[model samples]
Target: MEQIVQAECCGKTITISTGKIAKQASGAVMIKSGDTMVLVTAVAMKTAKEGQGFFPLTVNYQEKAYAGGRIPGSFFKREGRPSDNETLTCRLIDRPIRPLFPEGFLNDTQVMATVVSADKDNDPAILSMIGASAALMVSDCPFAGPIAGVKVGRVDGKFVANPTAEELEKSDLEIVIAASQEAILMVEGSAAEVSEDDLLEAIFFGHAAVQPILAAQLELAKKVGNPKRDIPAPVVNEALKARVAALAKEGMKQAVRIKTKVERHLAIDAIRDEAIAALVPEFEGSEKEVKGFIEDLEYDLVREHIIKDGERIDGRDTKTIRAIATEVGLLPRAHGSALFTRGETQSIVAATLGTSVDEQRIDSLYGDSRKKFMLHYNFPPYSVGETSFRLAPGRREIGHGMLAERALQQVLPKHDDFPYTIRIVSDITESNGSSSMATVCGGALSMMDAGIPIKAPVAGIAMGLIKEGDDFAILSDILGDEDHLGDMDFKVAGTAEGVTALQMDIKIGGVTREIMAAALAQAKDGRIHILGEMAKSIAAPRADLSAFAPRITTI
Candidate 1:
């Protein structure tokens, strides 16, 4: 039996159904908004894998070539690995719901969102997000979520929910906001010189618009949703946790305050070893619990100091920017190059100039589209003082590159003004925190180094939050530790005048608009300071490009 439900949203019909297709999946749902449609499935193993420390939640978003009436243009005549767009869409779906699952219920869950139909007017990214949430709601998994996503645009001072692809091109703001009925989970977007107040208003409006779609999904789940699984909670020896904490408490407390990452890591490991040697004889079969307890203790201590005492791990003020260095035209043969370093995070970005014949042609459901301006970000393990094999770019690399690209897209010259194709590559040589923001600063300098007439120099900064009960603190230019332990990862990019790109991911239920306003204001100040440092190296585009750069004489 097929159960279907519909809702009116943003001047369009949003239809959702289940039980008609993908019945083999543990849970499946089809979601439609405008002419765009997506089929999402939720599945999980009956039991978790042994010794799996992290919850394995995979969200795969695919665009079938046939969705937009196209065929595979590759030699294999089939879909290969996930494309950049697909990977980014996957991250969008993964960020909001990953934190909503029951603790210790890691049963190898996977949520797959396949775009079966694309209208080219409405993006399938948001539809995929909604569909994945609905599928999880109907599944037997212990997912504590019923989230929905929306795309909001600002046109002529009015907010438009689920704006069309055309309207987005003309609009000054392009934001995607995903939320539960009570709280927001994720936010990603780029805008013009919009104020903090207007941005908050747009977000609130988008939240109100998503209620209808969420309501429709809930009604559909009620008709065909399965009974949640009955799995017993894992046994934890409370005595083991207490003993381990008592043994390692002082050592970890001292380790947490170490300024450098390497020293802190080594110190924590030593404490763990000492505790294990002392207690392993008594607690023979409780390795996992002992280790988990120690980690939890460390997390609590670090979070407490930040929220209560305002003591950052690096011993810096909450709003202080890290030491920065920026330089341009380092590569002699390349068209343009710039090396940007802020504290430990660094990137050597290079710009390549080409002709119309060199543009990258993307063949997807949206048909063959050519991108004249592109950015690629690469991160090698060696850059992070580690050892690992290298392969194709992963989700993090793709997401970061896309973010830096969005940050620079607003400042690039129009197609008619700059007829040549441009591409920038950011090679991370070192990373500690906000390498994505480093890429943005590096990309801007590289373009200017190549004599690209960008409207203004763009820079980025990452902001973090530490929230405990009613208390909270926002940290600007956060270190990697703060980002890992903090409640929010808020990244903002723009010129000195205003913001051009913004992304926020929260681990808690949500944050108030007041916090967002404060973060945005702080980010602006940090961005201006970074740009001032960048101006010292090269303030604007050069008179001419490199002598060895590609020359394309337009006829």
Candidate 2:
């Protein structure tokens, strides 16, 4: 069935049509906004792999040269590994839709969105997120989503939904919100010191604007939806579960309260091994099941303690930030280097100044695009005290680096003013929580140390939420444990003036605007405190670049 569903969103026509492309897939949709188009297709494996523990869904978003009327610029003339932009876009589409599936439905589902067309003004990522949702909604998979995504920009004082590039350039905000009619499910964007109240209004306004787009998706699914295949529910051994719970409850509580991250991890491992030693004989060859039960219990214990007892794993108040320290000009030979440490989390961020020759150039359908400012983030396993071998930078590193880049993008001097290419590399040597925010703080310091005349010194902080129906606590400078066990991770970055960047992701189905407002306020305070501590290191940019760095001047 070739069906096209259309809607008017923020003065632009959005068209989602199915049945014409990738017909063999479970579900497929082509979304168009102006000349920008993305073709998203969803596919589910016929059967789950034996002992598949987690949902094996993969979302890949790619940009083809043909989409933007360009050719792939490579020796082989072939597309290879995903670009950082594509990787970040994949995260954008994956995070919101990943949770809407049944917990036990491990159907190796895949959603792939390719930018088949690009209008330079419109971003394909927004369309990709929308297309991914629409494809999954109509797929023969148990996806409880018809989620709609929109880009919210505030220029001057008024909010604009899905604003143009020109508007975004002048806007103080660039927020992307994904919703499910009931509440906001996913949000990731950067702002320019926007207030908590204004950010809240923009969120609500984005929610309202997506209603029609959601309706259009529903209509499209109605016409060309597939018959969902039902995978049998995961069978549970309640008797075995009860026995493990009774045996490990007290021991687990003791393990979670350990002060040090490594000690606590070791204790949990010992407990898991002890539990397995006790249960494996009874349920022979079901060691995986036994281990899974204990892990679930671990999550329950941590989450319940936070929500019920108003307790954090680290024994800090809900709104209390951890002790912070900052240092700059650490590397004598480098252009710029800063060390930002917040409790167990730390970042060694270095900035380099370059000329026009050093600008990162990407040849795509969008034409010869160049960026003067680039940020790279690296997370080695040793940072988290893991001994496992590591691979190349994955989606997390790319996403984190991009977030930090956006956090400081507004404060950067214009190319004409600075006439230099700037690159910031943030290395996570130790991590507990919000290493990306640490990057933001360290990146700013490194830039100043490199003598980039940034408008202001920037800092960032992560705010968490532990909500239990009516009772909720907004946490500041959350630890890794809280992030894993809590309801929300709301990260805000900015200078003394206001918020320059923000990102929020929730485990629960949706969070109210009230919670969002509270998180923003709390994050702002935390950011300010972090900035104050950073001031002890360097108040402003140095008057001169390093002698090692090349001098950049307008010719």
Candidate 3:
């Protein structure tokens, strides 16, 4: 039987339909808004792969050429690998739903969203996100979702929910917000240095606007949704857990206090190994559980230290930022260069200038458009003291680069004012956490070093969250370890005047508006502090372009 539901959102109607196609899959839904349509399907393995320690969830968003009434541009006359936009859309869909699955359910799951039709006025990405959520909700995938995605833009002064493409071009703020019925789950967007309060308002506005869509999804699910699969509780050996805790408790307490990341990790690993060795003989066939308990102990200890003592792994207070060091014009031969180091994270950014011919030509469903500025982020293995294949830049690098690019794009001179094609390359020389934020700071300085007349200098910082029941703590300028162990990784970038870009992802179900507001306020302070430190190296754009830079003549 076909099940359909529709709701009015932002002056437009969104329709979701299921049970008409892809019926063999665990769940499938087709969502439409305006002329744009996206079909999303969810599937999961009946059982998890043996001994799989981590959940393997894949999300793929593909755009078919036929959907846009166009032929493939490639020589083969067919669609190729995932495009940058597709990869980013995949990420956006994945972020909110990844944390919704039960912890013990490690079954291999996949969510695929394919654009079946595209309209020039409406964006299919938002529809895809909504479809993914609806599909998961109807599936027997054990997913805790019924979330919705909305794109909020400010036209003139009012917040416009689900703005059209033409409206977005004129809007000063463009943010995509995904939320559940109660709280916002994911937010990623760029703005024109919009103030903090205005940004917060836009977020809640978007969140409120999606409530109708969420209602429609629930209605549809109630009619046709499959019974969710049962997830077995993790088997716990109380005796073994108690024994391992007793053996490693003291060592873990001492290990977590060490300031150096490498040293602390080594100490903890030593304790874990020692506990496993001593207990494995007695608790045979329980090595995995023993290791799990030790890890849990460490996780608990770290959170306790942070919440009760208000201290982080680096001994910084919740609101304090790490030491910052910056240098510009360090590479004499490059067009422009800057090295930005914050705590253990570092980025070496170089800027290059070119003519109109160098501008990137991007072809997409919305048609071809030329980008006057480009940013590429590279993360080599040696940056983290590791060794791996030097393949092409992966999706994470691309995503980070685009984020930093968005952070700086708002401040760049208009194409009419500065017609030269600009490209900034950020190479992460070292990383602990917030490397993307470091890229943002370094990219700004490098552009200034190249004599680009930017509107203002931009800086970025990453904030973390640790929530346990009624208590929660937000950490500013979080380290890599904190990002892994904490519940949220929220990054904000902007000029001292306001915010330019924001990206947030969380492991928990979601956070309240109050928490989001607090995080943004803390991020603003950290961003300002980082900016002040950055100004010490180079206060503004240079008086002239680099001597080696090519001079462009506007026709």
Among these predicted structures, which one has the highest TM-score?
3
Best-to-worst TM-score order: 3, 1, 2
What RMSD value applies to candidate 1? 1.6
Model 3 clash count equals 0
lDDT of 2 at 417: 87
TM-scores, all candidates, are 0.96, 0.96, 0.99
Model 3 residue 118 CA deviation (Å) reads 0.3
Question: Which 10-residue window in model 2 sums to the lowest lDDT?
Answer: 224-233
| TM-score of candidate 1 against the unseen true structure | 0.96
lDDT of 3 by residue, 1-555 (tens): 999999899899999999999999999999998889999999999988999999999999999988999887888988899988999999999999898999899989999999989997777989989999999989888989799999999999999998887899899999999999999999999999999899999999999999999999889989984788888898889999899988999989989888887788889889988998999999888889988998899899999999999999888999998889999998998899999998889999999999978988887876788988899999999888889976588889989988999999999998888889999999999999999999999999999999999999999999999999989999999999899889999999999999999999999999998899999999999998899999999989998999999987778
- In order of listing, the candidates' clash counts read 0, 3, 0
TM-score of 3: 0.99
On a 0 to 100 scale, what is the lDDT of residue 269 in model 2? 94
Alpha-carbon lDDT of model 1: 0.88
- Write candidate 2's Cα lDDT for 57-169 as tens digits: 89998999888777788888878778777888899998888778887898688899998889977789989988998998788888888888899998889999999889988
